[model samples]
Target: MQATRMISGRAIPWGAKNIDTDIIIPAKWLKTVSRDGLGRGAFESVRAVPGNIFDVPANQGAPILLAGDNFGCGSSREHAAWAMLDMGLQAVIAPSFSDIFSGNAFKNGVLAVTLDEVHIARLMAVAADGAIITIDLENQVVTSDRQDRFAFAIDPFRKMCLMQGLDEIALTLAADDAISVHEARQAEDAPWLVPAQG
Candidate 1:
């Protein structure tokens, strides 16, 4: 995972609600555990159409995605966030998001921003004209050209994880000293409680 403090780049507006994890990376692309090359399969079904948004050159390597309400719904697939990260997207803006997808994305250092519908529509309009946008996770704000700005909320723990690039394992390892101390105390209190042989 990479630290996600602030991401500034062109915005790709995808105004579609109920975009599930299946639509994000597709089930066919789930065989590989590696995150690499998963971007090629992102939004495959939608990009198959001529002149689709994701296929456009202006949106190539865009760091931010503006989507409709209820984005990242359906199955709790971690690959969905992995594909987005592989595609160089650092954040997703929507009116709302599925809880599971949001958690998965946050753990992977993808900023999932929930803004009001008014702000989302304005961002969509600006994105149509190919405007650059900035998402400041630390500041909890999204800004773009024409002075369009919106604020969002995020859990403190999740925000810290994104800022420090701490995944689940990294978080646990952070408490290694405390865990060791506890184990030592337990062994001292109960010598025979420890398993003798495997």
Candidate 2:
């Protein structure tokens, strides 16, 4: 996981509501466990149209995505975030998001920003021209060339983990000393439970 303090780049506008995981990676593409090669499947359905925003060259490698309300809704598929990351998206902005998708995204190092509908609309407008958008996760603020600025709230623990690039296992490992102490106590309480050394 990479630490995401601030990101600046053109935002790929995907202003559609209820974009479930299926639409993100498609069900057929889920066969592979590897996160690689999933970018080709990202928004496959929407890209059929030749003029789709994502198909446009300017949006390629864009780090931010400006989406509609209720983005990333429906089934919890971690693949959705994986595909987006493979496509080089670092963050997504929307009015709201599915709780499961948001959690998965955060764990995968994707910043899911939830703002009001009005702010999302403004962002969509800026993204129309593939304008560069800046997100400061630590500061909890987003800014764009249109002079748009908005503040968002995030759980402190989640923020810390993202900033420090710590996943669940990493977080637990961070308490190695405490875990060692507890295991020593357990060994004293039940010596038989521990396997005897040969």
Candidate 3:
């Protein structure tokens, strides 16, 4: 996972509430195990409509999405986060998020910012104006070119992992030396517990 200390770009003004995982990436797209190409399926249903916000010309390649309350509320599918990243969304701002989706997003290096409805409205307006918005994870704040600033809270551990680009596998590998030492100690303490040489 790439570290996400800062994200600066136009945001997609999608304030639709109660958007579930199936809506983010339909279940039909879940047949494959690979994360690649999921972007084509991201918001498949929404894009089917004429003149959807996501399909608007100005919203192309936006790195941030401004969503309404309770974003990412549905089945515990990590694909939702993957699809968003593949679609070039580095962060999502909303009034709230489903706990499972938030965890999955964090694991995949996607910044999910939670703010009050007032802040959401302000950001949504800024996004609709095609203004640049910035997410500074280092400072735990979101800012817009319109001089709007909103502070958000995140778990310290999750913040550290994202800033360091440390996924669970990276975190486990970082403790390799300690794990080796423990294994050696166990071998010395109980010979029978150690696997016999082939």
Candidate 4:
């Protein structure tokens, strides 16, 4: 996972509510075991429509997504996070989000920001005008070039993990010294429990 402290870029202002996992990447695209190429299938149904927001050239590769309430709802598919990452989205700002989806996004190194409806509407307006939005994870605030600023709350542990770029594997590895010490003590206390070497 990449460390991220600040994310600043134009945002895709797709304020449609209740966007589920199926709408994000679709089940048919889940056939692949790898995360790569999933972006091509992301929001396929919506993109099918002419002049959809996701298909807009200006919004292409935008690092931020401004969405409506109840975003990322429905089935818990980790693929949704992968698809977003592949699509070059690093953060999603919404009034609310599905608990499962939010967890998945965090584990995948994507920032899921929750703000009040008023702030969301402001962000949508700015995004519609193709203005840049900045998310400062360290400061827990989102700002726009037009002087709109809103503070958000995040779990401290999640914030720490993201700032340090520590995924589950990396977190476990961080305790390697303690684990080694415990194993050594166990070996000394119970030699019979130790596996025999070939």
Candidate 5:
């Protein structure tokens, strides 16, 4: 996972509501355990349309996505987050999100910003114009070159994890020295609990 203090780029203005995990990355693409190449499968169904936003050249590789309410609403699949990262999206802004999806996204180092519908609509308009948008995690705000600024709230712990580029594994590894010391102490204090060597 990469440390992300700020993300600024043209956003994909797909504000469709109730977009589920299956829609983000169809089940057919979930057979593999690897997260790589999921980008080609991201929004697979939507991309099948004649002129979907995901297929638009201007929106290609945009680091931010502007979505409507209930984004990532269905299944508890973590693949949704994986697909988004594979597609090069660093953050998703919406009126609301599925709790499970939000947690999965956070764990995968993707930022999910929740704002009111009015703010989301404003961003949709800005995205339609292909204007650049900036999301500053440290400040907990999203801003546009047009002077549009929207403040958002995030869990302090999650914010810290993203800013520090600490995934669950990294977080656990950070306490390695403490864990080693604790184990050594236990070995000395509780010899009966320690397994005998072969």
Candidate 6:
């Protein structure tokens, strides 16, 4: 996962509510476990419609998405987060999000920001005008070039993990030295319990 201290860029501004995992990436795209090419499948149904927000040229490769309340509301597929990352969305701004989706987003390094409805509306308007919106995870605030500022809250542990680019694998590897020490001690204390060294 990549470190994400701040994200400043164009936002998709799709303020529709109740966007589920299947809407983000349909089940047909779920056959493969690999995240490669999943971006092409992200919002597959929405993109199929004429002049969808995801198809707008200016919104291409936007790092931030502006969504309405109850975003990512259905299913617990980790692929939803994978698809967003694949599409280069480092953060999502919404009034609220599904608990499962929020967890998945955090684990995959996608910042799921929760703000009040008023902030969402303003951001959507700003996005519609093509203004840049910025999210500062370190400072826990979202800002716009037009002097819009909104603060948000996040778990300190999740913030640290995202800022440090620490995934589960990285977290485990951080204790490598300690693990080695423990194994050595166990072997010494109980030779029969330890496997023979190659």
The top-ranked prediction according to lDDT is 6
Superposed by TM-score, candidate 4 places the C-alpha of residue 114 at a distance from the truth, in angstroms, of: 0.3
Mark the regions of model 6 whose C-alpha exceeds 4 Å error after superposition: 169-198
After TM-score superposition, what is the CA distance of residue 129 in candidate 1 from its true location, in Å?
Answer: 1.3
Residue range 86-168, candidate 2, lDDT tens digits: 88888998888999999999998899998888888888888886677899888999989888889999999989989988768
Query: Deviation in angstroms for 170 in model 4?
Result: 4.1
lDDT of 1: 0.88
Write model 5 residue lDDT over 32-139, tens digit each, in one string. 978788888899888899788977899989999999889998888898999999999989999999999999999888999998999988988988898899999999
lDDT of each: 0.88, 0.87, 0.91, 0.91, 0.90, 0.91
TM-score per candidate, in order?
Answer: 0.85, 0.84, 0.86, 0.85, 0.85, 0.85
At residue 125, candidate 1 shows an lDDT of 93
lDDT of 4 at 4: 81
Model 3 worst lDDT run, 10 consecutive residues: 164-173
Clashes of each: 0, 0, 0, 0, 0, 0
> Per-residue CA lDDT of candidate 1, range 166-197, in tens?
67686799999999999999999988888889
C-alpha RMSD by candidate, in order: 3.9, 4.4, 4.4, 4.7, 4.5, 5.0
Residue 181 lDDT (model 4): 97
**Candidate 2 deviates by what RMSD?**
4.4
Given candidate 3, what's the lDDT at residue 176?
99
Off by over 4 Å in 3: 170-198
In model 1, which regions exceed 4 Å deviation?
173-198
Candidate 6 lDDT by residue in tens digits, 73-172: 8889989999999988989999999999999999888999999999999999989899899999999999999899999999999999889987777788
The residue ranges of model 5 lying beyond 4 angstroms of the native Cα positions read: 170-198
Candidate 2 lDDT at 118 equals 86
Clashes by residue pair, model 2 = none
